[model samples]
Structure formats: structure tokens, C-alpha cells
Target: MAEKFLQAERYEAHRPHVRAVAYRMLGSLTEADDALQEAWLRASTTDIAEVRNIGGWLTTIVSRVCLNLLRARQARREDDIDGVPQTQGAATVVDPAAEAEMADEVGVALLVVMETLGPAERLTFVLHDLFAVSFDDIAVMLEKTPAAARQLASRARRRVRGTPPPTGHVRQSRKREVVDAFLAATRAGDFEALVALLHPDVVLTADPAVIPSPEPVVILGAHTVAKGAMAAIERAAATGVALLDGECGLLMAQGRGLRLILRFAVQEESGLITEVEVLAERETLAGVEVTAL
Candidate 1:
């Protein structure tokens, strides 16, 4: 009984850091809390009598729990594509306002980029780069060699950092400007500005993964496209201008969950958007190259 009490006390002492690690790994506060509780459960049930490093042991336990959660999340996303319903885990009600604030506090861009990483890559990066966990420890957790773990972290770091902004290209810079203006208008809910940025015959195409239709949906004309864009004004705050496949595009996300990538085709003379492609299919999204502008 005394040993159990001592273990519980020690868990409490390390709760904050462990919870932070879980948050970085899972990118969701509700899920992070769940991971913490599960970690504590595992820790309490196990005997640690001869354990030399209690803190490291606790971190490993929490990280493993988080890694399992990340893997399960990936599986559920794949299942979603097959029309399989997924039930949520035991999670507390999340307030959008609070979540947004926390995202800001944690660097929203970083979290958004991290969402694109694979489960093991994300875990390795967060544990090593973010928390200073040694690669040796990460390797054991990931069942890989220390060198392999380092390689995973290296790849993740590159994706998170992204490529530098384009230079010496007037056309590319202009397209970026237009995208920036479009995003600004969307966030401000300015109908006229949105219409001005689009050509009269502008075409907006979306994959079925975006709208649940049997086939891809297409909308034409500036007014029609502007109205559709306005309808998604609420998403503006969560969207950002990014370079997709070396073209100006928008990456829309909600609380670290990427939803759609909007690729724009702009006419050089008119400087107006001619076509907009909305991609949400998992395969398409995975293949997209997102560079922070």
C-alpha cells in the first residue's frame, strides 16, 4: 500500500511535463489527458522496485501510450474512407475558443505541420527534438536502431520547417500576393474582394472526398465561387496560404486536423484566379507538397 502511494505521489509530481509531452505527441488536449490517465494506470499497476530512473520510465510509459493513440487514430482515419463508422474515445467536451487559444500558445503552424507526419516520425520528433529525449531511448520505444530513430526525426524536422519562400520570380510572388489577399478577404467575409480576386469564368472543382458526392463537383463563375467561399467564412480563421506543388494554394485546417488543400490557377495578365482545385482525398492530400510561404 505504501509503495502504491509513493508511486502515485511520484506520478503527480511529473504530471505536468508528461501531459505536455502527450499534448505535443497527440496534438489534442482532450486526447492528451486521456493518454495521461492511461499512462498512470499502467504505471500504477506495474512494479518499479528496481527502477533506476523514475522520470525516464514515466516518460516512456506516457510516450508509448501516446504512440498507440496516434496509431489508432491513423487506423480510424483509414477506416473512415471505407465508410466505417468510428466512435470517439472517452474525451471531455472541448471548447473551440479554448482549443484555439491553446493552439496559438503551442504555435499553430507547428502543430499543423506536425499533422502531416507519420505516427512514428511524429513521436520520434516530439520526443527528441521537442523534449530533448535521447535518440537511444526513442529507438527502444520505436523498436528501431538509434540511427534509424535519428533519421526519422530528421525527416519530420524537414517537413515541419518547410522550404524557404520563393525568390526572384515576379509571377510566383504575384500569385502568392493574390492568395494572401484571397485568404484575407475570406477571413474578413468581404464578398466584393473575393469576387474581384476571381475571374468571371473561374471554375471551382472539388473531389468527392470533400463533399460526399458520387463524383467530383464543379462550380463556375465569379459570383458562384464567391458565394461558396463566403459560405466557408468560418473556416477562414483556420486556413493559411501555402505553396502546393510549387503553386500558390490554401491549406485549411481545424484544430490541427487538415481538411482541404485549395490549389489556385491564376492568369498572368488579369492576375485573377482562373481555377481552384479543392483536394481532400487521402491519397491526393498525402501526395501534395506543402511549402510555407
Candidate 2:
């Protein structure tokens, strides 16, 4: 009993650190909190005495939990071709726009760039670059060699290097140009043109309110997602250019009723639009900043 109490105390000491790592990996506080709870449950049941570095152990456990969540999320999103938003409000009744509002507070620009990475790449990058986890530890978690883990981090690093430092409006003008091109192509329903405007591996994720389907849709690749973009020509034609949480995006309204918001992460290298996250929750849309087209 005494040992258990001591272990719990130690875990408490590291809880905040574990949480920050989880949030960085998952990009959702609700998911991050869930991951932390899961980690605590696992930690409480394990042989705490066997562990040396409690902090590292807790981090590894939480990261693995977050990775599993991401994989499951990706799997769930695969079938949401109809734009069904996943029903997620029952558990936590916080502000719907809280996620977008967190962008500025949590380095939203970097968070947006991180969303573009794959599960393994994201895990490797977050654990190594942000938290200073050794590649050996990362490899063990990934079931690969240290060299392989290092390589993954290196690849992610190259991509992250292109992300600007999230200056307020220094790049908004340039970003608007990219977003305009994509919108123009989307409004025209020019499949080829839309694909050309998007990165070959572009990703599109959206909230349920905007998508109005049973599950949230996450379409990947320029061609597959471009088809969806083409389908939204009417909405595209009606969308106004806006700044979502300080990043370039689109505002959608229906005769003064603000309907949805489209946030973007435009790539600097190829001048291609890489990510399009639609937030249609009325509250979320309310928080978006609309700028001049």
C-alpha cells in the first residue's frame, strides 16, 4: 500500500509533462486527457517498482496510447466518404470552437503543420523533436531500430522546416494567394485544376456539422479529395476568404447565417494547399476571423 501511494505520488509529479506531450501528439485536449487517464490506469496496474525513469516510462505509455488513438481515428475516418461528422459532444460539453481557439494558444500554425504528418512520422517527430526522447526509446515503441526511428524523425524534420514561425500576418497575403487559387479551381469544379492546386498527398478533415454525415470524413490525396472539392462547388462559390484563428481560411454563410469555416495550411515550397479542415459547428464558425478577399 505504501509503495502504491509512493508510485501514485510520482505519477502525479509527472502528469503535467505527460499531458503536454500527449496534446502535442494528438492535437486535441479531450483526446489528450483521455490518453492521460488511460496512461494512469496502465501505470497504476503495472509493476511500478520495475521502472527506473518514471518520467520516461509515463511519456512512453501516454505516447503509445495517443498513437493508438490516432490510428483508430484514421481508420474511422476512412469510411466517412459521405461527410458524416462523428458524434463527439456527449462526453465533454466544452465550447465547440475551443479547438480552433486553441490554435493561437497552442501554436496553431505548428499544430496545423503537424497534422499533415502520418501516424508514425507524427509520433516520431513529436516524441523526438518536441520532447527530446532518445531515438532508441522511440524505436522500441515503434518496434524498429534506432536508425529507422532517426530516419523517420529526419524526414518529418525536413517537412516541418518549411513551416513559417507563425507570424501574425506576415504570410497571410501569400497564403491568401494559394487559398484563392484552390477556391477558384474548386468553384469551377475543375477536377484537374483543383488537383493541381492541392498537394498530391493533400488531406481534408472536417467537423460533423459541416459534413452532416454519421461520421467525420478525412479524405486523403489530391485526386480523391479533389473530387470532394468539386462536389462542393456551390459552397465554394458562396465561401468568402477569411482568417481562421489567424491562419488563412474560408468563411461560409447562408443568407447571413454563418454556416461553416474552412481552415488551411498552405505549403510554402510547392505553393500548394496541403490541409483543409472544415469547422462547421456554429460556435466554432463564430470564432473564426474573416479578412478581405
Candidate 3:
């Protein structure tokens, strides 16, 4: 009975960590939840006496499960007519105030970029680069030679070289400043200032489930995006939604629950905002924490 209780405690302790790992690997909450359930089942069946570090063991199991699922998904995509794997495009924009609200969690831009990698590459890169897990341990879990795992990480690194490193602690602080400016412009209905911060090649996409447009509504120039922002601001003003700071901030609904929350990313060429992305879905907001603004 004591042993069983101990095992239960260990499981509970590692549950949140496991969910985070699974979410990062799979990029889908439903899939991560399934992987977590399987990890728990495997943990329960194993003999607790042999497990020295229950947390590590559980994490390993969950990672492996998520890796396998990613591999299978890749394989299925390969068999499709186009023979190209599906990739997540740029995220939808939300109210800057709403985004300011969720600043404590993962950045939306980082999450979107993560979807560009293969499952193996993402898992290896995240483990080795983000978590500082040793290459050897990652190799063992991935069932690959250490050298191969190293190569996988190298390729993933090359893919992201154009973008700023996502793991930097300083990036978060800089992003908050950009988001604040964005919300203020939106609230004040300043289209020209809003356009000044956007990149020339900015793209805007509405939720497909909501908009059902076949193609992503790509807005090419900063001026064009600013015009659209002006229209959106007018619409939002009609609804009494105000931008906080310079970005979309708070989102309150009558009875339907809150709508889109804003999150921002600023790509710096020489310490200026280049690319800005906003994410509003609740599922996307799960890992994010909103500060009181």
C-alpha cells in the first residue's frame, strides 16, 4: 500500500511537466492529453523499485510516445497526393490588450515556427537546445545514434537561423514593450503609427472555422495592414473593445466568454519591430500567463 501511494505521488508530481513536454512535441492539446494518459498507464504497470528517478522516467516515456506519434503523422502525410507535410502558417491576430494579458506564457510566434519542424527534429532540438538535455540521453530516447541526433539538432538550428532564438529570456521583455505600443495605437485608432511597426511582408489570417476563406488573407505592405487595422479599430470601437497600451489587451464578452486575446512577437533587425504576430485561441493560451495591466 505504501509503495502504491508513493507511485501515485510521483505521478502527480510529474504530470504538469509531462503535459508541457507533450504539448511542445505534438503541438496539439488533444494529442498531448492522449500521450499523457498512455504515460501514466505505462508508469503504473512498471515496478517502482527499479525506477530511481520517476520524473525522468515518466518524461522519457511521454517524449517517446509523442515522438512515435509525430513519426506516424509524418509517414501518413508522405503518402498524400501532394507528398508534402502540412505546416502551420502564420497565426491569427488578436486584440493587443488580450495578448498583453497572456504575456507570461509561450510566445505565439515561437509556437507557429515550431510547427515547421519535423517531429524528430523538433523533439531533439527542444531537448538539447532548450532544456539542456544531454545529446546522449536524447539519442537513447529517440533510438538514434548520438551523432545522428546531433545532426538532427543541427538541421533544426539551420532552419531557425533567420529568426531570433526563442529561448532568450531578454526577448520576452522586449516583446512586452512592442505589444504595449501596438495596443495603444489600436485603442487610439492611430492607423499610421500601427503601420509603422508592421513589416512590409506582413500576413494576416482569420480563424478558418470563423472566416472559412479558402486562402490566407495575406496583407503585403505595412500601409495595407495599417489600413486594415484602421477598419478593424473602427469595428472594435463600435463594440466597445479598447486596445491596451499599443496592443490588443482585455477581451470581455456579454455571455459568450472572452474572444481573441492578443500576443505579440517583434523581430529585430537592429532593435526595431520587424514581424508581429498575435494569437487568440484559448487552447493556444493554455501555457501563457496574463499579467495585470
lDDT to native, each model: 0.83, 0.74, 0.60
The TM-scores of all predictions, comma-separated, are 0.67, 0.56, 0.56
The best candidate by TM-score is 1
> Model 2 — which ten-residue stretch has the worst lDDT?
88-97
How far residue 145's Cα lies from its native spot in candidate 1, in Å, is 5.3
Model 2, 68-150: lDDT tens per residue?
98888777678789767565443433353554444334554456556667788899999998899999999999999999999
* Per-residue lDDT of model 3, residues 198-290, tens digit only: 776665543432234664344456777666555433434212222323333333221112334433445665443544333344555444433
Residues 1-293 of candidate 1: C-alpha lDDT, one tens digit per residue: 89999989988988988988998898888888888888998998888888888888999999999999889888888878866546676686777766665654565556777888899999999999889999999999999999999999999988987776567478888888998899888878888999999999999988898778999989999999988776543556556776677777787666566678888899999999999888888778768777644
Q: Count the backbone clashes (under 3 Å) in each candidate.
A: 0, 5, 24
Where is the poorest 10-residue window by lDDT in model 1?
Answer: 100-109
The better-scoring model by TM-score among 1 and 3 is: 1
What candidate 3 gets wrong by more than 4 Å, as runs, is: 82-104, 163-180, 183-293
Better of 1 and 2 by TM-score: 1
